[model samples]
Target: MRAVPTLAGGFPDISEMTVARQVHWQRWLAAAAILVVLAAIGRAFVNGQIEWTYVSRFLTAKVILEGITNTMVMAVLAMALGIVLGVVVAIMRLSSNPVLTSVAAGYTWLFRGTPLILQLLLWFNLALVFPTIGIPGLWSVRAVDVMTPFLSALLGLGINQGAYTSEVMRAGMLSVDVGQYEAAQAIGMGRLRALRRIILPQAMRVVIPPLGNEFIGMVKATSLASVIQYPELLHNAENIYYANSRVIELLIVAGSWYLLVVSILTPLQMLLERRFARGALQITR
Candidate 1:
C-alpha cells in the first residue's frame, strides 16, 4: 500500500492528509466537558439563584418584540438614506467641477471628523440653531417641533453613515480600471452618462461587500440613539427594564434581538457578495 502525501495549507485532490483522530477525540471531549459545566450552571440557576419568579412574569415578550421591530425600522431607514447620499457624495468627489468636489470633500471631512454621538445630539438639537430650516419667501417648517428624537436620530445616523460610506465608495470607484471609463467615452456616452451607465455598475460590485459591513455597524450604532430618547431597540429595552427593574433581562432581550438581526443580515451579505463576485473570478486564459 502506498502512503499518501500530505500538502500544507489544505488537502490536495491527489493527496489525502493524515486525519488526527486523537485530536478530534480530544476536542470532542473538551467540548463535552464545557457543555457539562454549562449544564451544571444552568441546573444551579434554574431554581436556586436566579429569582425566576420576577424574570418570568416581568419580562414581557411584546415589549421586547416591539424593540426589535423599532431597531430594524431605524436600521433600514438610516441605511437607505446613507446609501443614497453616499452615492451622491462619491459622484461629486469624482466630478470635473471644483465646487462639487469641494462640497463633497467638506461634507465627508466634517462629518467623519466629528463623533457619531455628537452628531446625533447635534441633529436632536438642530431645531435650536435655525428654528426653521427653510428658504426665505418659500415653504417653512419648525425644525425642532417637526424633527423629534426619532427623526433626529434617523437624520444623524443617515448623514454620518453617508460621510463614512462616501469614502468606501470613493475607494471602490478608484479601484475600477481607467480602460472602462475610456471605453464608455469611446461609445459616444457623455461623462455623466458614462459614469451612470458604466462606472456605477462596476463600482457597485466593489462597494456592496463593504457596504454590508457598514450596515452591520449601523445596526449597533442605533443603540446610541437611545441616549437622545429615540425609541430604538435599546431605548425600548430601557423602558421595559425601568418599569420592571429587570436590567439584565431586558439587556439580554435586546442583545438577542440584535443577534437575530445580524444573523439574518449575514446570509444576505453573503448572497450579495456571491452575486458581485460572479464574473470577477472568470479567467479568459
Candidate 2:
C-alpha cells in the first residue's frame, strides 16, 4: 500500500488528495430554510391587511415629531441622572467603609429586583403613601403635584438605570490593574483624584460600549413611560391611532423613528469607543 504523504512537521498532508471531501449539507439546508422564511415574511408584508399608506403619511406628522423630541429629551436627561448616580454608587461599592458598601448594594438590589413598569406606577401614585414631600422645616410640595407623569417617569427610569449602571461601572473600575492604582497612590494621588484623573479614563475604555448599549436600550425603554401617560413617541403614537384607528401604521412610525435614533447613535458610539480605546492603548504601551 502507498504511504500517505507527510509534511515537514510529521503531519499528514491533506493536499495529497487522501483526505475525504465532506459536504456541508446542514449549512446548505439552513440557508435554504432561511431563504424560505424571508420570502414568506416579505410576501406577508407586501400583501398584508396593514395600510402601508398610513405609515408613510404619518411618518413625519407634527404629533410624531413632538413625540420624538420628548423621547430624546427624556432619554438624555434620564441617562445623565443615571450616570451621576452610577458613579457615586460604584465608588461607594469599592469603598473600605461597610456602611457605604452596604447602602450601595441595597440600593442596587432593590431597584434591579423590581419591574420598571411597577416602579413608574409607584412613583406616579406616591401621593397615596406620602401626601407631601420635602425636607423637614423647609418648603414642601404635594406629592401628586410634584410627581406628574414626566417627573414620575424620569425618577423611575433614571433610578432604575442607575442600578444597572453601577454594576457596569464597578466592573469597568475593577478591570484596572491593582498596580495602576498603587502607582497612582505612590504619586501622592488621593483616591478621588486618582479615580477622576487616572482610573476613570482607562476604565472608560471598558465602560463605554455597555453604556452605549444602555443608552440605546433606554430609547426603547422610554416606551414604558406611555403607561404613565408621558407624551413620548409610543404614547403619542397611541393617541394618534386611538383617534384614527391606524394602530399598525402608527406603530410603524414609532418603530421607524426609534430605528433612526439608534442609527444616529450607533456611529457616535463607535466614535466614542475609538477615542477611549486610543487612550487606553497609549497607556498600556
Candidate 3:
C-alpha cells in the first residue's frame, strides 16, 4: 500500500505501517497447562476401577428410567407449588398491612433458616408428632399413611423452595419502576388488577432467568430426597450400586443423566429469556 505525504512533515505512512498484534504468551501457557491437567483427569477416569459396562448397562435400565421420570415429575410439581406460594408470599410481603408483612417475613425466615435435609426428615417423621391428622368431625387418617416418602419430599422441597422463590419474585416486582405503578393507579385499575395486568407482566422479563436457574437447582436438589427413601434417580442408582457394588459406575450413570438434563435446560432458558425480553431488545435497537 502507498501512503500519501501530508502537508505537515510527512505523517508516518499510515496505510503502509504494519500493526503488530500482541502475543499473549502467558495465556497460551495457562491454556496448555489446563489442557494437560484435564487430559490427566480423563485418563485416570478411563483407567479407573469403575466398570464402564455397568455404567452403560444401567444408564438406560428400566429402574433408572423410572427413577429419572419420578425425579422430573417431582421437580416440576414442587417448582410449580413453590412458584405459586412465592407469588402469594411476595405479594403479602409488599402489602400495606403489618400483619401480612410480618407473616410473610416469618414464613421466609422459618423455611430459609432450616436445612433442607432436616426439613425432609421432619416431614417424613411427622407421624411421630401427629399420630392422626384430619379436620375435626371429618375423615381422619393416620399421619404415617399420609406422609409417605413422596408426599413428605414434595412438601419439604416445595415449602423450602417457596422461601427462596419469594425473594426472587419480590426482587422482580421491585425492579419495576415506581412510575409504572403510579400510571396503573392513574387508570381505574385497583391494586390487585394493576399488579396482575401491569406489574407482573413487566416483572416476568426480569424474573425468567433467575427462575430458570432456580428450577435447574430444584432438579438437582431432588437428589437430597433420596435420604428420605424417595426413589429419585440418585436413590435408584444407590440401590443398584448397593446390590452390585459398582459404586463409581452407578454414580457416573447418575451424573451423566444430570449433565444431559442441565445441558438441555441451559439453551431453553436462554430462549425463554429472549422471548421475555423481546420488547426491551427492540427498544434498545
Candidate 4:
C-alpha cells in the first residue's frame, strides 16, 4: 500500500489519531475505575452491613449535649491553668537568676519526661504520699477526699500541659530578636514592662498557632482522665456504654461530639490567628 502524503491546501494526513483516542479512552477508563470503587464503598456503608444504626442511636441529644459540656470544661480548665504556669515558666527561663532557670528547666524536664497517664495515676493516688494535706495552724482537708478523681485529673493534666506549654512559650520568647530587648531597655522600659509590652506581644504571633493545636490536643487528652474515673467526655461515654452494653454506639456518640467540638474550635483558632497576623502580612489585589 502506498502511504498518502498531504500536499499544501489539501487535507493534511493525520497520523497517530489512534494514539490520541487511546489516551482519551485510558483517561475515561481510569475515571470509571475510580467511580466504581467509590460506589462500592458507598454501598457498603449505606447498606450498613456495617451497623450504622447503633452509631446513629448513640448520637442522641442528651449524649451529645453532655459530651460537649464536659469536653469544653476540661479543655478550658486545662488551658487556663497551663497558660498561667507557662507564662511564669517563660519568665523564669528568661530571667538572669541561675536558680530560677534551673528550677524551670527541671520542672519542664520532669513533667514532659513522664507519661501523662502515669502522672494522673500518681495524683489519683496522692493520698499515699500524705494522708492529710493542709496548713498545720489553718483549716485542712483530707488528702483522700480532696484528691478525688476529678481533682487528680485536673491537677495532673493541667500541670503536665503547663510544663509542655512553658517550653513552647519559652521558644517563642527566645525567637524574638535580642535587639528587641535592648531596644525596650534603651527606651527605659522595665524588665516586666519590656516583656509584656514589647517582647511578649511579638512572641504571641509565634506562640498562638501551636497553642491552638495544644488546646485541641488537650481536648483529646482529657479522655485519658477516664482511667481515674473522671467523668470527662470519653469517661461518660464509657460509663453509658457499660450500663447499656452499647459499646460501639456510645463510642460513636463520643466520636461525633468530639468531631463537632474540634470543628468549631478550628475555625475560631483560625480567626484568632488571622487577627494576630495583622500588620505582619500585606494584602494584594
Candidate 5:
C-alpha cells in the first residue's frame, strides 16, 4: 500500500476504505460465528434426545412450584441477613477503633476466603464438632436439632454473603466525598445521624446497582443449599428427575424458572438504581 500525504505532514495518511473494509470483515466473522453457535444450540434443542415434552409437562409441576417458592424465600432471608451484617461490618471496618476494625477485617477475611460450599457443609455438619448447643441455663438444644437444612443454608449463605456485601457497602460509603462528612459534622450533626441522613442516601446510588447484582447471584447461589439436602428449587427438581429418570427435562424446568426470576429482577434493579441516582445526576450536572 502506498502512503498518502496527511494534513499533518509528519504523519502518514491512512486509507479510510482500508479501515472500513477490515472492520467489515471482522463484523461479518463475528456475525457468522454467532449464527453458527445459535444454529448448533437450536439443533440440540430440537433433537429427540432431550424430551421437550417432559420439560413442558413438568414446567408447572407442583413440586417445582414449591421449590421455586423455597428458593425465593431462601434468597430473600439470606440477603436480608447479609445486608444487616454488611452494614454493621462496613461501619465497623470504617471505625477508628482498632479492635472493631480488626474484628470486621477478620470476619470478611474468614468468610470471603472460604468457598461457599465448604461453609454450607461446615454449618450442616457442625453437630459433629459441637454436640450440644444452648444459651447457658436459659435454653438448651442439640446441635443437630438446631442446624436444620434451612438454618444451615441460611447461616452459610447469609454469612458468606455478608462478607462480600460489607465490601460493597464500604466502597459505596467511601465513594461519598470526604467533605460531605465534614460538612455534616460542621452542622452540629453526630456521626451516626450524619451517616443516616446525609451520607447513606448518596451512597445508595452507588450501592444499589452492585447490590442488585449480588441479589441476583444469591438466587443462583441458593442451589448450593441442595448439597445440604435443602429442598429449594434445584433440589426439588433433582428429586423429581431422580424419581422420573428424566434428568435433562427437569434441568430445563429448573433453568426456565431461574430465567423467569432473573428476567423479572433485572428491571426492578434498573428502576431502583435510577431512583437512587436522582440527586447524583443533578449534583454532577
Candidate 6:
C-alpha cells in the first residue's frame, strides 16, 4: 500500500491498495490433466496404423478436390432452397387461415419426423412408386432418369433443413415486438408488405446466428448423401480407401478438409452476424 498526500495539507493521506492476483490451483491441475490426455491421444495417432504419406498424397487428389467442390455446391444450393422454403412455411405457420397453418404443420412434421437417409433413399428410388413423372401431355420422363443422386440429395437435405429452419425463422419473427406490426398497419401497409419492409429486416439480426450455424450443419450433412451415391467429400474418401485399403488415412484427410471448411466458415458467419446487427445497440463482434 502507498499513501498519497492530498492537495489540502489538512486532509488525511489516501492509501492506494494493490490487488493480489489469485492462483487457482484447481484450474491449473485441470489444465495440466487435459494437456496430458491430449498429448497421449496425439502420440497414439502419430504411432497408430494410419499412414501419414497416404493422407498427404491423397489430400489434394483430383477426386478429393472434386468431391469437396461438390460438397460446397450442394451445401450452398440446399441451404438456399431451405431458406426459401422455411420463409414460406414460417409465413404459412403464422397465418390466420386454419388450412394454411395445418398444411404447413403437416409438412414440417412429416419431414422432421423421418430420418434424412430414408428420405434420400426414397427420392433415389422414386421410380419404384412413380415410374414416370412430368407434365401429362406437354412433357414426360422416366422417374429413374430424373431422380439422380444429385437431385435426391438436394431434395432430401433441403426439405429436411427447411423443417428445422422454419422454427428458427418463426422464432426470429416472434422475437419482434407486436407493436411493430401494429405500427406498420397504422402506416397503411399490408401484412405482407409490413413483413417485408419492417419485420423481416429486424428479425434477420436475431436469425443470422442460428441460420449461420444451420449452414455449417448443412455442410457436414452433405456426407449423409454418401449413402445414396452422392460423390461428396466423404464418398470420394470412401472410394479411395476402398481401393487402397487406407481407410483411416483417407478419413483423416476428409476430416481435415471438413475442419478447414468449418474454420473458414466460422469467421464468415461472424462477419454476416455483424452485418445484420448494424445499427443495433449491441452488435455481434
Choose the strongest candidate by TM-score. Answer: 3
lDDT of each: 0.85, 0.95, 0.94, 0.87, 0.94, 0.95
Encode model 4's per-residue lDDT on 108-186: one tens digit a residue: 9999999999999999999999888998888787899999987888899999999989988999899899999999999
lDDT of 2 by residue, 28-107 (tens): 99999999999999899889889998999999999999999999999999999999999999999999999999999999
Q: Candidate 1, TM-score vs. the true structure?
A: 0.80
Q: In each prediction, how many residue pairs overlap at the backbone (N, C-alpha, C within less than 3 A)?
A: 0, 0, 0, 0, 0, 0
Arrange candidates by TM-score, descending: 3, 2, 6, 5, 4, 1
lDDT of 5 by residue, 155-203 (tens): 9999999999999999999999999999998999999999899888888
lDDT of 5 at 227: 99
Q: Please provide, for model 6 over 29-121, each residue's C-alpha lDDT reduced to its tens digit, 9 standing for 90 to 100.
A: 999999999999999999998789998999999999999999999999999999999999999999999999999999999999999999999
Worst 10 residues of 5 by lDDT: 14-23
Error of 6 at 20 (Å): 7.8
Worst 10 residues of 1 by lDDT: 49-58
> lDDT of candidate 6 vs native?
0.95
What are the runs in model 5 whose C-alpha is more than 4 Å off? 1-23, 282-285
Candidate 1, 1-285: lDDT as tens digits: 775665687655463545655457888999999999999988875755445555555445776667667878899899999998998999899888999999999999999999999999988888789899788798898897878988998999999999989898888889889999889888899988887788887888888989999999999999999989988888888887788777776676677778878999999999998798777865564
- Per-residue error (Å), model 3, residue 177: 1.4
**Number of residue pairs clashing in candidate 1, backbone atoms closer than 3 angstroms, sequence gap of 3 or more or interchain:** 0
What is every candidate's alpha-carbon RMSD to the true fold? 6.2, 2.8, 2.6, 5.8, 3.7, 3.6
Error of 1 at 187 (Å): 0.9
Task: Look at candidate 6 and give me any clashing residue pairs.
Answer: none
TM-score of each: 0.80, 0.92, 0.93, 0.82, 0.90, 0.91
